[model samples]
Target chain A: MNENRKHDSNAQDRTDRDWDLLYEIRQRVIQSVAKNMDLFGVTPSVGRLYGTMYFHGQPMTLDEMRDELGMSKTSMSTGVRSLQEIHMVYQTWKKGVRKDLYQAEEDWYKTFIELFTTKWRKAIEINSKEVSNAKGLLEHLWQNTHDENLKRIVAEDLEKLQHASEYYDWLSRLVESFETGEIFKFIPKKSEA
Target chain B: MNENRKHDSNAQDRTDRDWDLLYEIRQRVIQSVAKNMDLFGVTPSVGRLYGTMYFHGQPMTLDEMRDELGMSKTSMSTGVRSLQEIHMVYQTWKKGVRKDLYQAEEDWYKTFIELFTTKWRKAIEINSKEVSNAKGLLEHLWQNTHDENLKRIVAEDLEKLQHASEYYDWLSRLVESFETGEIFKFIPKKSEA
Candidate 1:
């Protein structure tokens, strides 16, 4: 009886060690991703959610995530919804459970491209307008300035603006290719399904 | 006298029109940048501050920015500090102002290089630990699996992580070039001083 009890305690100790390691990794991942996302203007909660999904190693049901992250059901529900809208997270149904399982999208680069072209595209569009306005300002300076050097500089700026449009166009095409999954062929993942 | 009154009113109306246009541009630039920043995982204020500085045509004094953006003094102070910390914004003294003026670094792409590398370096460090943990999991699967295909898949995953590190290295080099100012030389600006 004493031998059996000793063996049981040893087994429990091993389990506790495994849990501790898992917990530590989860915390570190969360902290690093949260800081980066904060810089990127993504919410800490969103980073936590995605990091949790990535480190967890498989799809996790909402209940599992809630328990793991120690978050309330309402917060998880809203966070998962927001992640889905951005195409960073996806949901799938489980056979036994009624609750939905969520996972981070595997392709990091493509996820970034989707975000860039959709949300950041607006900024680029606004920039294009600003560039046009700057051109007008340059033209004004060109006509008004008696300084020959300043006039030449303004003309150079005007030409640069015309050529810079090509870079933006190229960026748009790169984003399109990522969105269409052309980049995935190069990635060599373990499995698709 | 009646003609003089009409002329004054018309002048006032045109001034109002110009103010409205500037206001509209300010608001759109803020809103667009705010949305992009959120998508990227940084704060809305960071986006607003950077966008405003970028479009302001030249570096601006903190007080000048406060007036232009119509933000509270405290908000501008915090936003400018945050931008400076990220290396996206810089602090410089003007000839007249006692207080420091803020400027978006001249080579914007270099700033982006720092941002991307700092972020990717963090991800790689964390993922390296994850790869170690994953190795244990793979070893466990190798011990347990009778199925050759599943074992083969795990081996492929292991191999992919090795190759993926090469991609990360390549990406690092690509982003590092942004700091070298080669791209900036390709596009001419109106004037430096």
Candidate 2:
């Protein structure tokens, strides 16, 4: 249990209250991260495990995670898989280690680019397809109709659909820029962040 | 039912099948919108109502919306209020109009800026505050501790918190730029979306 004894040159002596203070400090961030995980469509418990792993700053196995979080091993496994799927955590092969290990992705910007670009691209594809279909129907309706009133109404709707298609096209480009990291050229992630 | 007859110069003579065709066309967009509305954290039905109103391209009363969606009036009212809260729809007044009219906010870019900036800012504020508090506690512990191992651990944690704080600051600036439309200058929302 005493990792300090194994590696440290000096004998360690941290009081219970000192450990409590350290726990309290990280608790704030862990809670905050858990709350914000909702933004990424994850439950708070899964987010909490990620936050705990982030603070650990070490590769962890499912058993280690379960021991630390007091969650069931099954739950820990599911949580880690979910986090990995969202680009928040990754499974790693540790040298000389038999059990598979997992690590948290510390770079938030990289995670955002990877995750959001995929989601945005999917949404853009779905919406653009719908717009195209609607445009085809409206255009056909507009051309075939002998009635001027029907033509006018269909034409108006067609124009709106055209605008929506254009928007979807632009959004597709934006999604590409994100995936390519070209957006950083415009937003400039050069500073401390 | 025959507003076109009252307004148009000629009498209308369109079959029921023409109306069915038009409905089919709008159905695609309405379904697409309903699916995407999950991004804004609304139910599909509410999003469907917004999409229907968007295609209508005019201010409509609650009763009119209920009739169009075939939803109960109470459900319509709730959906309208939820849409208004998210800046997806707005209450508009017509000259001497008795019943209040609600219109969809068709500009998606404006809606994105308004909604996301507020949510991002709140997240930035919360995470930054937590980082500040953690930094304060760690710094104090590091200074007081004679144990080099404890100090080293706290120092490492402190460094992480500092980077996190900087990220939050940069994110805050990004949120403000979005709110002020300053980001558009760099990304250039010029072409379409």
Candidate 3:
């Protein structure tokens, strides 16, 4: 009976070690994803929550996530909500469960398209408006100025603004295409056998 | 003669007003560009220098840029050098001028391609390496573990890392296509008569 007990303890020790290793791996991946998300203007907590849900591969409740991630309930709720708004996470229903369960989308391509299109489209729209304003100001200055050097300078700058405006307009459309998956249509796919 | 002098003075005042308006416009554009560059992890000074040179539409000496932009000689030199390294700015020689003159590339398409390819490729490369490391650790755990729960969890997480690594690899290739202008070939052009 003592030998059996010793064998059971050894198995439990091994299980603990395995859990430790898995936890270490999960932490590293979460950190990496969080760092990358920082580049895209996302908070580290949001990335961490998403990464956790992704690897968990099962719908998790807010309390479960909060406990597992050692985050406050408020933080977990906010992060999960933000992820849901971005379509990175979604709600899942479990039979006989009243609380909502959330799971990571796991579709990286769709997630990227949604994230970048929203970001780039907004950026392009802002820039386009600024370019237009600058162009208007320059044109007004050009018309009112009489000096040859100043006229030439204003003309050149106005041209640059117009060029930039056009490019941003084009970029906005490109981002729209990205959203619609039309941009991918341009990419060549391998021929099927 | 007194009346003529008054007229000349009035003309000078108008020129000054025009210059003031142009300067204000330039400042606005520079600020906008600097803010956008911040998103890409570039310093504000670099974006300002690029905007100034782009609007100037002429090769400018470092001293000239420093004096006009109210920046220190050291900052001007460093900003210009960084811009040159990225191929956004290039040195040009003027006849009878001994000092090197720098000018903005002014080709927005080329500039975007060069800047984004360099930044995104580095990001993808780093993420790919991290994903591979995570995958290795997970595979190691999977092999060493006998518990079915741990095995299933590691297998699922391993699949995620593999998927992410593949996506990053594909994105790196897409950036290469952008560098080669092969991606542009896929873009539909305006019909020519």
Candidate 4:
């Protein structure tokens, strides 16, 4: 290796130039992703941290991530935790590595499906239960009331509840499509061509 | 009509009880809707304003909404304006009515479709354009670079861009599914029964 030092240095210089160009292109993409991550319910800074890790194209330890992004280690951990909670990032066991190494889930479709479907499903579960309970209460009122006025009001409320119940059922199916990847049949994840 | 004064008084008391029960049921629904409105990106207070108006079951003027929700009139206007921009609420002219009247869009499915489809579509447009531009620049670099190492790096980045482009295309179709109501066929707005 030492005998070819002169040739290796030239190769190294060109290699550095190639890497720099790659970085420049990936940087803009990182910026774009970071700016739009409010849709993911994360702060822009946290988004930037994830974007940087993603574009780096390799698993990184917390210290390396903090150094690369110049973020406080605490903030990086917080961001990583949030991403983990959403299943957007996860720690991987690197051979013989003592430090925890993290990798971004590169499939954007899967990321969107996990984060959004979970959120909407949770909301649907809680809201639908409350709605069902309210419906039951209204139905009970309707049965107990001898007065025409109470019955009429309860009947109208019951109709409104019925409409809302239908909406939740539709939303639940929408979440299931994403969770089950049934949506991909309609909207293919890869380009057909 | 005044001849049945005693009977009318009894009917009015029962009517008030009926109205109170209706309000109780609707209030919980409104509260459930409000708690989940963070998904729409508005503050809870703003969501509460919309929920109150929605359950009010009529076109309400700004003053009326403020009075009903005990919010400042300014906040009511702000919330209404935000909801209107997102197509969740709208202004309607009531004939012979001087004040501007606002109505909540009652169809939750349509509301979700409009808000999410627009947001995801806008994001896809911007991100895909930037990605295409970056891909073009990398191709330009690939063409000029004689170095094998540089060529390899450019090729890899191009593959990454290709993958990302595919995801964006899929997301664009997802937005279209919502906009065109293609998703409704998959997840019907009404229950099958």
- C-alpha TM-scores of all predictions: 0.63, 0.87, 0.83, 0.88
Q: What is each predicted model's overall lDDT from 0 to 1?
A: 0.62, 0.81, 0.82, 0.84
Scored by lDDT, the top model is 4
Native contacts recovered by model 1: 0.05
lDDT tens digits by residue: candidate 3, B1-193: 6999999999999899888888888889888877777655568888888888888888999999998789998899999998888898999999999877999999887887787788777778777888899888888889989899989888888888878976776677668878898766654222122
- Write candidate 2's Cα lDDT for B1-193 as tens digits: 4777665533233434566688888987899978986766778999999988888889999999999999899999999999999898999999999998999998887877777776777778887888898888888988877767667778889888877876676667667778888866756655632
Candidate 2 segments exceeding 4 Å error: A1-14, A190-193, B1-14
The local distance difference test score of model 2 is 0.81
How well is each residue in A1-193 modelled by candidate 1, as lDDT tens digits?
6999998888767656554544554466456655555534468887888777865657888888788779998888888888888888898776887778888776655566677567656656765666566556666656765556545655765665554444445444444545675534533233333
lDDT of 4 by residue, A42-159 (tens): 7888888888877766898999989988879998898899999998898999789999999988888889898899889988998899889999998988886667866876787688
Candidate scoring better on DockQ of 1 and 2: 2
| Better lDDT candidate (1, 4) | 4
Which model scores highest in TM-score? 4
For candidate 4, give the DockQ. 0.56
Give DockQ per model, in order.
0.13, 0.47, 0.47, 0.56
Off by over 4 Å in 1: A2-42, A55-59, A94-97, A125-174, A180-193, B2-59, B93-99, B104-111, B122-174, B177-193
lDDT of 3 by residue, A1-193 (tens): 6999999999999999999999898888788887777656678888988888998889999999999899998999999999999899999998999888999998787887788788777667777778899888888888878898999888888888877876675566667777888766664232122
Q: Report how far off residue A164 is in candidate 3 (Å).
A: 1.5
Rank the models by TM-score, top first.
4, 2, 3, 1
Where is model 3 more than 4 Å wrong at Cα?
A: A43-46, A61-67, A70-86, A90-102, A188-193, B43-46, B61-66, B71-87, B90-102, B188-193
Residue B36 local lDDT, model 1: 51
Q: Model 2 over residues A17-70: C-alpha lDDT tens digits?
A: 566788888988889978876766778999899888888898999999999889
